[model samples]
Target: MIKIPFIVSARAGKLLGRENFSNPEGAIIELVKNSYDADAKSCLVVFDIVFKIEKDEDGIDKKILNNDLSNIYIIDNGEGMSKDVIENQWMKIGTGNKETEFISKDKRVKTGAKGIGRFALDRLGFKAEMWTVSNDNNGFNWKMDWKQFDNSDKSISEITADLSDNDINIAEFLKTNFNHIKINNLFNEVSFNTGTVLKISNLKDDWFEKDIAGVFKSLEALIPPKELNMSFEVNFQHLQKPKEFGKVETAFFNDYDYKLTAKYDAEKLSVDFVITRNEMDIDVIKKKFSELYKNTKAPYDLKTLENKVFKYSKSINELLELEVDENNNKLLKDLGSFDLTFYYLKYNVSLKEGYPFKSISQKERRNVLDKFGGVKIYRDSFRVRPYGDTDNDWLKLGARVAQSPAGAGQRIGDWRVRPEQTAGIITISRKNNPDLIDKSDRSALQENDSYEIFKNIIIKVVKEFEVDRSKILNVFFKHFKILNEKLRENEIQRRAEDLVNKIIEERKVVEEKLYGKKYNSVDLFQQKRDEEERKKYEEAFKDTFKAIDDEKIEKDNEEIVQIRGLASLGLIVSSFAHELKEIKNNFDDINDLENIYTDLVSNESKKKIEYNDGINIIKSLKLDTEKIIHWVDYSLTAVKKDKRKRGNLNFIKYFDSLSQEWKNVLKNRNIELVIKKDTKAKYLFRAFEMDMNTIFSNLISNSIDSLDMQIKPAILVKQHF
Candidate 1:
């Protein structure tokens, strides 16, 4: 049979370049990644745009004339390629060189694998020129006209690019052609004998001031934060907008209200998380905090640190149908470790008062969020695409907020945080998580088991941030509301007192004129004054009582809301308990059959079943199942439906039930729990049983925590009549 040869047309360049890149920003970023893979310490991006200065209300503004005089230049001090290397590797499409040698000489993970990154030049402009010098001091000039590839009849091999050896002055070239003031200083600061310079003309897109600013913002976060020991740096310069030029640093808010960090450990199947409130914000809230009602106080608890192991939590284990080892450890061995950091800002009109952080205006804060919000994923210190983009709700936070809007089942003035209110970074690496692969289009991580687990874990951590932030914000809003109400009341009382005094003086003057000296008679005047004073005292008492009553009603409403929230949680627990009972029953049936089979096999083989591997496996499974069933029973007993209802709860019976329920747990911990009766009289109270459970649960849990360090620990519940 005759072998058929595959043919590729020159037009294929369009598919790889223009069609592949969703935007000019992405195309430029791809080229920058190439520079990074070359182990470059610094990369400079210049937007050469022709513009005329125009005066506006905000002073001088650059008006971009047109794209006719726009050119883009990207320069990097990297290990420049030789002629042979350029032709064999850079010139070839879909090269596998990077795939084979995935690490650079400096031990940096190669960011480009597909090797079509060179086509990014075509995506940016119609014509491109390059100048490069290798370590041997040998220079080369390369030029390509992308318009030549538009011809459908031309074969890929026929369309040739110009590449030739030439001696080039790197510094002189920039001064002679660009004629920019910063060029001389930049070349002086960055000393390099070997590097690459790419110039693109006949621009594909107009380079306006706004466009340049957008690109600069993206470049700011293109690499990991400097604190991560990322040696590389990026700089941006717009020739027309010289004032906007600066070194790109990671864009983050230094005055964020809350910062949360979560680190996962794959070996332990656990995540350690820390949530910290900004000290300045906490201080401001504390200062503003007032007794809105009698004896009311703010939730002053600020941050939390928890090392949560993945274990018997059905909500977590059910996520992956996870397998447990003999020691009851989840076998999520494939899910690799990752670190996530998030910063949150509670932006509301109420927060305007006592805003203790940097005095960022509302407009400025919103602009910052609009520019640098959303959670982005970084791999090998480079950001992946589309995940943290302004409109890309990869975490689906917006949808979650929509499902449970403010006041759905939460405290008053508490709302779910919107996607724009947070900025975050999730760091991952190929060496750690090989399964989380990127798609060819560089859109996002491929939809796979590892990726799903990764997103779920991040969402879970973010939930912690949201919950704590809500609590603090709720307090702030309530205090603000109370302050406003107090001010209004004070103003009304002042006006009322003024009006009453005016009317009383006017009546006294009229009475003096009508009745003469009789009106001034001691007995008659004294009786009238005494009556007026008595009436005023009664009115004052009524107003004061009304204010107190209003405060009491408000306090009661808040308590009712908290109780309802607990009831909501109890509802969830009850539902899970039902499902757990079903699961336990099914497992018990399986265990019984396994036991019977083990007995039969032992009899048939004329040996004990304990020596057989199959019997041992069954026995281990049964033990785990029994443990799970016990956990289910404990939960079901703690969250009985009747506990969530309001009624006359007998403290004696309640304490007795709690002692019985906790007897096994306390026994296992080598601790004793006792309920002491102080009197023979019945002790009862009107309350939601769940509220009592919550109060006692907190007390008991705290006692257990402290008991861990005690040699002998006991919990006593005293019942008084």
Candidate 2:
């Protein structure tokens, strides 16, 4: 066999760094993740922007000069690398050391899997320097000019970085080099023997206040949920505006209207949903959730409802490949158990200081949602990218709601959830769900059977939350509507009072000007005239209010009339449908009439030939009559009084009847409908029969509609009963 070496171009480094990170914020986050993997208890990000201020056309000073001199410092009090490590793992491109040693010395799971995270520094700046002190107190300074990597003529192996050993004092180093005093003082306070400091200069992007704020917000999300108690801290400081940036804190969970905790059990093939109604804002709820799970570590409060447990449906379990192995142990093929905590809120923009809005202002709550309002996924106490991003709608919730908008009512499927209205975290670990792996770029989970099942289960849990929340929110909406109307009326009354006062003041001014301070019969006459004027104005004000009330009453009456009309129309339609069904039952002799015509045609030989075509036409017409009868029967069944009432129902039997009802319809379309029961047990459930019909009919209809262009279309309804 002939061996030929594959030449790696120097440009590969640039591709790995700039191409991997879409923005500077993402590149900075990668470095922070690296710090976490180093077992860092605290990481500090300082944006030391050196710029000259220039007055704009509006005479406002702006930092738009010398932005190229901006420097970013990312310092971490972690286990810094030694010389050997720098030469081997740190120097090597795409090193597998992290893959082999996935856990840190502190027993923290390594967050950075792709060894190329170091390249993030290159993405941020053309030149970079690293000052690191190892556990042995031996310090090393490494420098790299990333611009050299752009030389396409040179191979990656030919390029080299500079590394030198040095004696470093943490305090002395900051005093000598660090220009940002606040950040410098912070590092001096934290005593650490082993740590790494990255001073990146010759920046690629101009650092502005907004850009720095974005970085700060990203850092806030970088911290794992407090329930994990990871004890890691990240501080952000801007030299230009030091007060605005500080310790990265999470968005307030106490502001949530509803908290839903959902957990799936792999062994039991069951899912549990616990919903807690937070009278928080109701009482300005501010406490965090407290109970900690065995696998997923988070402490949440135990203000919970009676847990609702649902077993996996037959089809869902089949997709999961639930089975018993040869050793008599249960086995789940692709899917593992996962838990999700979701917080939902309905924003009130014009909130005033009161019971539900005391702790936080409306603006503050809106800002929080603007920053962190989407569902995010965390793996091994670290977040996965692009899943919960503002632009990333992995749940397709927006699309779902766009297709069928949610309304302010308590109806199944009517109150669809929106992406912005919720914030949540889904925690998964590599040990439990090895199949659900991230792609090399760490953008999202690999789209496989496991991922599909995972997304479906999450959406299912969210839907359950939506159903319960709709009932509560509708009442709130109605109360708000009434409150708003009362407030409007009060505003009108206040305006009326202001108008009457203004008129009285004008009359007094005119009277004072005309009647020249004469105390006598003239004063009395003026007083009498003023009293009459006051009474006339008061009467006009009352008349205006009366007119407003009359208009409101008229509108209310119109709405009542419309509702009654709709109810009467529905009764008429139901009556007609029943009468049509009765007529079809009594018209059974139509088939007998067809038989008589057939006999008449068959008796005369000459007429039989001419009537043969007519007879076939009559038969086809008879088939059309059968279709009409089927539709009428189905319509009559729908309006039955028993179906409208709620009771326990066998879902499997219901499906069987539903299938029979649609049997002829499907046959005409040449589509097959199959219902398979995995067990003999009755899947009894309490619900209105009409509700069940609505749910399944819509599902089946949508399924059939989508299959219009597919070949050999069929629907298989599988039940685990």
For each candidate, give its TM-score against the true structure. Answer: 0.60, 0.58
Q: Model 1 off-target regions past 4 Å?
A: 51-70, 279-332, 349-364, 406-415, 470-721
| Cand. 1 TM to true fold | 0.60
Q: Against the true structure, candidate 2 has what lDDT?
A: 0.73
- Candidate 2 deviates by what RMSD? 23.8
Clashes of 1: 0
List model 2 lDDT by residue over 251-333, tens digit each: 54767667788777776666666776653342223232111211221112222221222222323343334454533223333
Question: What is the C-alpha local distance difference test score of candidate 1?
Answer: 0.73
Candidate 1 per-residue lDDT, tens place, 252-361, comes to: 66667677887777776767766666624334434543332234433333322112111122233433345556433432447677888888764554445643443446
